[model samples]
Target: MSLENNKIFASVLTAGILLMASGFAAKSLYHPKDLEENAFKIEVSDSGVEVASAGAEEPSIEPISALLATADVAAGESGFKKCASCHTIESGGSNKVGPALWDIVGRGRAAVDGFSYSDALQGMSSEAWDYEALNEFLAKPKDYAPGTKMGFAGLKKVEDRANLIAYMRMQSDSPAALPQ
Candidate 1:
């Protein structure tokens, strides 16, 4: 019995040694070359935010004005489902996690009553939520207004943003005129 146990232990030790030797042999046979430049480079800011390298070209965003003309309000309404958790579109709807978005189009920034807006949005009080501004804001909330409390990452598709804006326009009693 002891002789049999000794044989099993010897076999296991030999297998482990072979496996380690094979790994070393495979690594020596396959030498990976270091990349001269990263395919995608990201930089970390002092605030620990990951920023795209300056050389990276951001995809050109089409103007919302052009898209809004033929934008599907129904589709936009569907998209608004994403915002429904935080906002209410119905007239006189009460504020939720986000302020009521009733007549948000063309409304002054931080205009909703009784909701606490972040200092970043409060600072933009002079600017109304125009289609273009909404376009940029919806593209990336953080990029549009750093330090904003809004946690939505934003819609990447310009068409989606246009549709949502169109739907928002309809929420008002008198929808704002579409841009020429």
Candidate 2:
């Protein structure tokens, strides 16, 4: 009985050794290289429909100008709820996780006092938070300012952005005129 157990252990050890050796041989025979870029790309819309291929040009974003004229401020107030966690919209509101957003429209980029902005935003100090800039930034924070610390994924719907901006416009002492 002891002899039979030894033979069984030896057979298992040999099998394991042969399997490892074959694995090493296979890996050495094939030198796999990572691709420089994705071989193919798939883009899906909000509705889950496949939208584009690898080579397709990015779909142009609809400008918010037309939508802002009649944007619902009430709806915008509701939308601002998403931003309230990080920002405060009232005048003289203290900064929270993000700087207070009172009168943010037309304010110079990275202009908030006492808040340390990322290098990416600081570098853009020359720019102001104009409607178009806000539109772009609010669409995709990372895309607009690559190294920004704002973790919000951004509002995808143009109407939602228009409403939010319109709401923000109302927060200022003198809201800038809507785009023509």
Candidate 3:
């Protein structure tokens, strides 16, 4: 109705258009591509379904036994920095948040003194801490021993697990031989 009113309307319309255009540009800039290309597939279905991507196969996990043959003990010791907060590796090392890991290789499960082990781990007392067992346990502690108190998410890399186990072997009075 008035020139001033027209100018105000135009300003508001321009601002709205600019804001909409910027939103569209941002959406185009940050839109995620198909996760299958990144080795991830989303599966949805009724009854809690799982779906496999059409194009990608899951990567095979190399057995820790194989990797231990060439595992770098030094690199493993370096990697142990991640575990230092929860464990002490020295001989007769008192239990920390978790049990002392000294001589852990080939040791019986839940055998450490004074440290209270979760029932999940204690259930594994029939087994020794062999290479295959260590690999599985270290790869995913929760998966390996459900209901256990170990809070780590586990190592995702085979090489890292192998190296870490190798380093742990060296901490023992009688280091276990690497798996063939």
Q: lDDT per residue, candidate 3, 1-180, as tens digits? A: 999999999999999999999999999899776664647556677857676677989665468887777889999999999999999999989899999999999999999989999999889888899888888889889978989999999999889998999999999988887766
Worst 10 residues of 1 by lDDT: 53-62
Q: TM-score winner among the candidates?
A: 2
Segments of candidate 2 deviating more than 4 angstroms: 1-8, 20-55
Q: Can you give the TM-score per candidate against the true fold? A: 0.70, 0.75, 0.67
In model 1, residue pairs whose N, Cα or C atoms come closer than 3 Å (at least 3 residues apart or on different chains), thus clashing, are none
Top lDDT hit = 1
Q: Residue 147 in model 1: shift from native, Å?
A: 0.8
lDDT of 2 by residue, 1-180 (tens): 699999999999999999999999999999999999889966789979897766989866678888889999999999999999999999999989998999999999999999889999999999999888899899999988988999999999999999999999999999998888
- Predict model 3's lDDT versus the native: 0.89
Q: What is the lDDT of residue 13 in candidate 3?
A: 100
RMSD of each: 5.8, 7.0, 8.9
Locate the minimum summed-lDDT window of 10 residues in model 3. 33-42
**lDDT score at residue 112, model 2, on the 0-100 scale:** 90
Give each model's whole-structure lDDT.
0.94, 0.92, 0.89
For candidate 3, the TM-score is 0.67
Task: Give one clash count per candidate, in the order shown.
Answer: 0, 0, 0
**What's the CA error at residue 115 for candidate 2, in Å?**
0.9
